[model samples]
Target chain A: MRPAEADGGARPVKEVRAFIASRGRAPASLLDRYVAGFGLVMGAAVVGRPIASLLGGLAGATDPSRAGAGTALVLLACAGYLALARAAGPVSVSGGDASWLLLSPLDRRGVLARPARLLLAVAVAAGLLLGLGLAAVLGAPDHLVWRLLAALVVGVSATLGGMALAVLAQASASWQSWVTAGVAVLVVLALVAASGQARPALSAAAHAPPAVLGAAAGAAALACGLLVRRALAALGRIPARALLAASTRAGHVATAAVRLDPGALTWIAEDNHWRARRLRSRRWPSLPGPLALAWQDWLRLARRPGRLALVAGAAALPAVLAQAGAVSATAALGMVGVLAGALAAASSGTAGARRDGDNPSLARLTGVGRGPALAARALLPALLAAAWAAAAFAGLALTGTLPATSWLWGPAVAPALAAGALRMARRGPVDHSMPIIDTPGGAIPTGPLFWALTGLDVALIGCLPAVAALLGGRMGDGSLMAAQALAGVAVLAAYVLRARRAR
Target chain B: MYESIITVTGLTVELGGNPVLTGTRLAVAAGEIVAVVGPNGSGKSTLLRCLAGLQPAGEGTIEVFGAAPSDEGPFWRRVALLADEPAWYPGLTAREHLELMSAVHTGPSRLTVEDALDVFDLRSRADAPPLNLSTGQRQRLALAATLLRPSDLLLLDEPERGLDAAFRERLAGLLDAYAAEGGTVVMATHDPLLAAHGRQVSPATGGVPA
Candidate 1:
C-alpha cells in the first residue's frame, strides 16, 4: 500500500468515519458540547415551561397529562420536521460510517448499523431523564422508573416513525400539502377548542392511564424504529456518484452572466460565492450582488411565520385589551403596529453584519457589472419591512384604529427604516471563520442579514412621528405623505447603493 | 530564473469608469513567493484578487500556473486564500469548518485539518469557537484550514497579520517549503522583514517591473 494512500494528513477526512473518530479522541469536546446542549435544553425548559404553564392557566390549568402530551407532540413534531428537511427526499442511509465502512471489511447492513445502534444510548439517557421528570411532576416515584424508561423508548419510536414518514412523504408533492392541512386543522382546533383538546388526536395515549401511557410510548417508539429502517433501506439504493456530486454544491452556470462594476460592495458580495465555488468559476456571486441572496434571506425569514404572527398579535393585543369595545380591537392594534414596525426595523438592521466581519473581504469575489446583489441587500429588507409594516397597518386600519387620514404614511416608513439601517449597516467587529448556514435548522446566518432587516424596522419606528402627523391630517394628507415616503426611500436606497459601491 | 506561473497585462481596475488601477501589469513565475507590497488603497489586494480570478480586471489579462486566471482553473483548486476576517457560522467548531470544506472538495483522498492546526498549534482548543478565540488564534485557524487544502497558487491578504513571531517564521518556512516543491505564491503584507523572503514588487502605482 502506498504511504500517501494510507495517510490522511493536514486536513482530516470529512467522511463519516473521520468525523466519528474525532468524536472519540476529543472526549472533552464532545462531552462539553453535549453538556452545553443539555444546559440549553434544561434552561429553555425551565424558563419556557413556566411561561407555557401560565398561558395554559389563563386558558384553564385543566390537565397536566394532557399538557404533557401536547408539549411532547409539539416538540417531537419540530424534530420530525427537521429530520424530513434534512432527508432531502431520502434515497439512502446518510449518517454514520456507511460509505467508508461498506468499502471496508464490514457487510453492507452491518456497516450501516452504527447510526442505528446509537439509538439505544439515546433511548436510555432520554428515558431516564424524562422518566425522572415525569415521576417528579406526578409524584409517582414508585412507578417512575418503569414509566419514564418506557416513555423514553416510546418517545424515540414516535419521533423516528414521524421522521421516516416525513422523509418518504417529502418525495410526494402532496406531503407538504398534507402537513399544511394537518397544521391548519390543529391551529383551528387550538383557537376554537378548550386547552389541550386538540392534543389527544395526536398523542392521546400519553394522557391515558399509567399502563396505557407506557404502552402508547412503546408503540410510538416501535413505529419510529420502522421509520429508521425504511430510511435506511431507501438510502441503500442511491447511486454513490450521484450522492457525492450532489453533496458538493459545484456547478458552473455558463448562462449566469452577471456583471457589476469593479471595487464595489456589490462586487464583494458576488465574489463570496465565487470563493465558495472552488472548481467552478461557471457559478459565482450573481452579477446583481446580494439581491438574490437578500430575496432568499427574505423567503426564509418569511417561513418562520412567527414574525408576522407576532406583529399581528402585538397589534391585536392592544385593541383586545381596550375597554372601549367601539375602539377596542383594531384601533389599538394600529398604533402598536406602527410602534412594532419601528421595533422590528431597528432590530433587523444588524442581522447579517453581526459586528463587521460581513465586510469587504467576505464579499469581494462575485460578479460586478450591476449592483443587484448589493441592491438586494438594501432593497429586500426594505421591501420586507414595508410588507410587514403594511400588514400591521392593514390590521390596524381594518380595526378602525389607524387614522384614515394618516394611513398613507405606512409605506413611507419602510424607506425610513432602510435608510437608517444602511447607515448602521457599516461592518463592526470581524469574525474570520463563520461558515454560511444553508439550512434553517443549522445555525442561522446572524450578521448583516439580521441587521439589515432590523434597520428597516428602525426606519418604521423613525417615521412614526411623521406617520402620526400625516395620519392625523394636521401635516400633509395621503398624497404628501406618500410622496415624502417615496422620496425618503429613494434617498435611503441611493445612500445604501453609494456606500456599497464605495466598499 | 523561473518560468512564469502568473502574468498580468494592461490591467486596470475602475469604479464607474474612474480608474482605481490604470495600466497595472505584473508577472511572476514558478517557485517564487512574490510579495505585492503597498500602502493602503494602492490596489495590492485588488491585483491579487484579479490574479486569483476573484475580481475581474477592468482592462487586462491574467494567467496563473500557465493558465489565465479563469474562475475555475486547476490552479484555483491548487490555490488558497487567507482572506481578511472572512465570514463564518459562529456555531461551527474548527473541525466542522474543515469537515464542511472536505465534504465539498473534489478528490480521491482525505484532508486532515488537525495537522494544519497542529502546525499552527491550535489542536488543544480546536473545538473552541473562532469568535471566542484570540485574533491570532482565529487567523491561524483560518490560515490552517486554507493550507489543509492542496494549492499551488496562494493569494493571502495580510495572512500573518495577527500571528506572533514563531508563527510568522513558520509561515515563511511553509512558503519556502512549498516553493521547494515548485509552487508559486503571491502575498500582500505590511512587514518588510517577512517581505524579504520574496522579491518585493511594489503593489502601488508608479513602480516599474524589475
Candidate 2:
C-alpha cells in the first residue's frame, strides 16, 4: 500500500478511487451488458452439456495415442502463448493514460496493480480451462475434482512463469535474447515429439504422482509470486518514454489484428528488424522513380527471408492437404485460392499502408500523383502473390493432384486480387461503418464496407474458377477458362480506374 | 509573483543505455515563460519530461511545486503537459476525447468539450474520428485537451511543431496569457517568435543554461 504522505497527504490513489466510486454502478441505459450476459448464458448452455457428456464417456479410457495427442496439443498451445508474450509483453495502456496518468505523481505500482492482476487472473483462468480439457482427454478423470485442481495449479504456474519471463525481458536484453532461444527449443521439442522420441517423457509428466505434482505446484506458486514482485519493481524504474513507445506499438498490433491485416505483421517485423549497421549509404540504381519504388518494395520482402518462407509454406498447404487425402483436388485448390486471396489482402496494401500509417509526408515528396504512385506500389505485391500462386499450382501439378489446365486460375486471379486489395488498403485505415439494418430482435451491425468489398474480391478470385469447373467438367474447361480470364481482367480494370480516381 | 515552482539538480537520465541528460540542472518560477532551445537530439524534451515526472532520473533529483512527482502525489494534479507528437486513441471521436480528458481530470476544469473544440477550431470536426483529422488538427486537439483543465504548471514540448506561423503566434499569445494569470510555462521550441515570448534557455550540453 502507498503511504498517505506520498501525495502531500492528498492521497492521489484515493482520489482515483473516489473518482471511480463517484461514477456509481452501471448506467441505466447499459442494455448492452444484459445482451452480452444473455449471449454468454446461451453459449454456455449450448456448448456445456455435450462437452460434459463427452468427458464423462472418455473418463478412465486411457488410450496411449489419445494421451500423446493431448500432450502434443497442450505443448503447442503453450509454445504459441509463450511466443506471443515474447513478441508483445504483458502490459497494455491507452495513449491517454500514457500521456496523462503515467507522468502523474501517483504510485506507479498502485496504478498498474489492478490491471496487471486482472490480466494475470485471466491467464490463470485460460490455463485452467486448457488444463481441464487436456486432463479429460488424457483419461485422468478418475478422481476428477482432485485431478482438475492439480492441473489448475500447474497451469497457473506455467502462465505466471511465462509472464514473468516476458516482463523481465523488458528490462534485460539478455532475457529478450532468451526468447528466440526458447522458441528454438520449443521447435526442437516439437520435432522430437513428431519423431515419437519424446512421447513417453510427455506422458509421464502428464500422469505424474499426485504428491510430486502438488510439491511442484507449490514451488511454482512461490516462484510466480517472486517474479511478479520483481517485475513490478523493475517496471517502476523503466523510462516512461519507453512505456509510451511500447504502448504505441501494442496499439498498432491490436489495430492490425482487428483489421485482419496480414501486412501488419510484416510491418511489425520490418519495424523491429535488427541491423548490424544502419543502411545509410545504401543506394539503388537510378532508374525511373516508379521503378525505383517498385524495386524498394520487392527488396524489403526479399530481405525478410522469414516472410518468403511463410509465403511458400502457405502456398504449399493446399497441395499437402490434397496429397494426404484431407480433401479433393478441386477443394484443395479452392482452399489454396482462399489462402492466396488472404495473402493478396495482406501484402497488397504493404507499401501504401506503410506510407499512410507512418509517413504520409514522405509519400507527398514523390512529386507524383496518387494514381501512378499507387499503381507502381501495387506491382511488387501483385507479382509476389502471382509467384506464390504459381508455386502452389506447380506443387499441385507435380503431385498429380490436379489437371494442368487448372493452373490458369493462379496467374490470372492472384494478381487481379492483389491489385484489388491494394486499392482497398490505399483508402486508409479509417473505420467507415454503414448504417445499421433493423432486425426482428434488434439492429444488426452493417460493419466496415471495405471488408465486404475485400470479401467480394476473395469470392471472385478464390471461388469463381472452382464453381465454374464443378458445373462444367472437362467439356466446359475451355469456356470456364475464358470466363475466369474475363473476370480477372474486369477486376484489374476496376483497380486501375479506382487508382486513377484516387488522385 | 515570481516564486520558484520547479527545481532540478544533478539530474542525469539515460535512454536505451545512452546518457541523454547528464548532470542537468534547472529552475523555473511561477508566472514565467521559459523556452528550451536546442538543436535536434539535444535533451530539451527530456528536461521537460523530467520536470513533469515522466522520465526517471538516473541520478540526482527533481522537485515540482516543492514536492517530487510520483504516482500517489498531488503534484501531477497541478501540472499539464503536451508532447510534440500526437497520441490518440483511434476509436475515439475528437469530441469524445475532449470529454474523456474532462472526465478523467482530477482537478476542476473551466473548459467544456464545446469550448475546447471551438478554441482549437475543431467544432466542425468534433464528431469526426481522429484518423480523419489532418496532422495539424491532431496536434491542436492534443494541445486543446491538455489545456482544457486549469493547472499551475504548463509544460509544452515543441508546441509550434506542425502548426502554421499564424497558429504559432496564437500559441505564443496563449502561453503569455497563461503566464500573466500566474501560471508557469515551459515550452521546448525552435521558433524564434514563440521563443521571444519567454526567457531563452539553451539546453545544449544536457543542462539548461541560465
Candidate 3:
C-alpha cells in the first residue's frame, strides 16, 4: 500500500464518481429524431391508410367476427401488461445506478422522476397504438373522429391503471405482489369464462361520446398523478436492497424473454418464493455425485408448482384438443410432435447443460467436459419430452391413426431435440456481453454472438422437419436410417464448431 | 518416481487486452504442492487458470501431462480447478450442489455429501439455497464440491479466501492429506501459512525455478 500506488488505484474510481456527480449522459438528440421519424412513418404508411381501409371494409362486410377478434387481442394485451408489471416490478435501476444515483445525495425525486416520466410516456404511447390497431381491426369507425378520440381515452385509462399497479408493487413488494397476483388470476379466470361475450367495459369506451370519454380519461390521469406522487414519495424510503433485487429480477425477465424459455421465468419467480418462504430442512439421503446432481435439478424444477403445471399443461394440450374434437387423433399427434419438440428445447430442467459454460471449474473438476456435460444435463428434459411424445402417439394409435412403429419416433426425436437444446444452453448470457453495433439510425445494443446463436437455433429447428418427413413418408428403414445418421453427424459437427468458437 | 504434471513454457496471457502473464514459465511434479504467490493484479490466478485449461494461452504453450492444456483428453479428466469466483446455481442448496458435483465427477474421490457438509460446518444450512449462504459458506461449499470430484491435479485460486484463521488451518491439513494421497496441487494464495507448505512460484517475477 504505497501512497503513489494507492493514489493510482484510486484515480479511476475518483474519475467515475466525478463523472456521476456531473450527471452527464449520452446526447438525446438522436433518440428524439428517431422518435419523430417513427411518428412520421406511422402517420404516412400505417395509421392513415389502415384506418381508411378498415372503415371501408367494415361498411361493406356483414360479419362482426373482426370486432370479436379485436376485442380478444385487446384483452390479451391487457393480460400481458399486467403479467409483466406483476413479475418485473415497476421501477428498476442497474447495480451502478443503484449505487451512484439512488444511494447518492442527489435529489432522489428528481433522479427517479426522469425514468418515471419516460415509462409513463412509453406506456401511454403503447396503449394508444394498441388501441388504434384494435379499433381499425374492429372497423368501428362510424364516427371516425370521435371513435379515435375514445380509443385514445381508453388507452390512457388502461395504461395509467397498469402503471398505478406497478408503482404500488414497487412501493410494497410482499403485499402488492400477492394482491396483484390474486387480482390478475381472477381477471384472467373471468375473461376466460366470459370469453365469447362482448366486453361491456370495452364496448362503452368504443362507442362513448368525446366529452364522456374525455372525462373518463381525465379521471384516469388524476389517478395516475396521485399514484406517481405516492410512488415517488415511497421511493425515498424504499430500501436499496429492494431496488437492487427488483433490478436483478427485471434483468432475469428480459434475458428469459430473449431466450424464449418460460422455465427461466419460473426460476426467477420461484427464487422470490424461496426467499420469501425461507424454508429449511436437514434430512440427508446420500447418492453418488452425478445421480445426486440430476436428482437435485429435477427437484428444483418439479418443486415449483407453477412451472410443473405449465409443463404438464403444455403436454396435455394435444389430448385436450383431441377430446374437444378440434382435431383428429392423428392431427393431434402431428401437432404434439412439433410442440413437444419446442417445449423440450425450451425446458430449463437441464441445469448441467445450461450452467456448464458458466462454471467451467465445475465441469473441469467433475471430469464432465462438453459432450458428456451436455448429455448429463439434457437427460431429464429428454425423458420428459419422450414421455409426452409417447402419450400423444399412443392416443393416435388407440384411435387407429397410425401403425405401432410410430412409438419408436418419440425415443429417437426427443433425444435429438434435447441435444439441440443442450447446444443452445451451452452459451450463457455472460458469453453474450452487450456490444453496441453502430447503425446509421442509432446504436443497436446486442452482442454479435447473440445474433449468430439465434440464427443457429432457428436453423436447428428447421432440421426437425427432415426427421418428421422420414417418419411420416413411405421411405424404407435403410434409407431413413442413413439420412438420420447424416443429420446426427451434421449436428455433432455444428456443436463441435460452437465449442471451438467458445474456447 | 517424480514426474512433472504441469509444464508452462514462455506463457503469455492477456485479459481484456492487458498482458497479465508475460513470458512466464513453471513446472510442478506429481504429489507436489506449488504456491503461485503475487500481489493483487500480478497474474497469480491467470497462471492457475492457464494450467487448469480454463484460459487460452495468448502466446507460448501450456502442457499438462505432456499434452496441450486445451485438449479435452484423459489429462483434463484428471484435473480440477476452483476458480476465484466460485459458481453455484441459484436454485440449488449447498448440499444439492455437492450432490451434483458427486454425480458429474467420476474421477476417484470417496468424499460423501454428508462428510463434506460436516467438514465445512454447512450441516445447519445444507438445505438452504445459495441466495441464503454467506460469502464464506459459498467458498466452503465450492471447496466441498472440488472434494466430491477426485483428481490427480488440483488448481485452486485464493484457496483460503473468505475463510477464518481456523478454517485456513483446516484447509492446510486437507491439502496435506491430499498430497499424502499422491495428488498434485497448485494454489494461488496470499496466505503465508498456505504458501509455506508449497514451493513458492512468483509468476510476477517470471516464475520460480522448478
Q: Score the docking of each candidate (DockQ).
A: 0.04, 0.01, 0.37
Give model 3's TM-score versus the native structure: 0.72
Q: CA shift at A177, candidate 3, in angstroms?
A: 6.0
DockQ category of candidate 2: incorrect
User: If you assessed candidate 1 against the hidden native complex, which CAPRI class would it receive?
Assistant: incorrect
Chain A TM-score values, per prediction? 0.44, 0.70, 0.62
lDDT of 3 by residue, B1-210 (tens): 899888888999999999999999998889999998988999998888788676899998899878877646355567777876554555666776776666655544458888988988899988788767788888888888886667888889898989999999999988888888899999999999999889998988889642
The structural similarity of chain B in model 2 to the true chain B, as TM-score, is 0.89
- Candidate 3 Cα RMSD (Å): 8.7
Q: A248-304 in candidate 1: lDDT tens per residue?
A: 211112111121111133323333333333220111122222443343334324433
**Residue B199: error of model 2 in Å?**
36
Worst 10 residues of 1 chain B by lDDT: B102-111
TM-score of chain A of 2: 0.70
Q: Which of 1 and 2 is ahead in TM-score?
A: 2
Candidate 3: which docking quality band?
acceptable
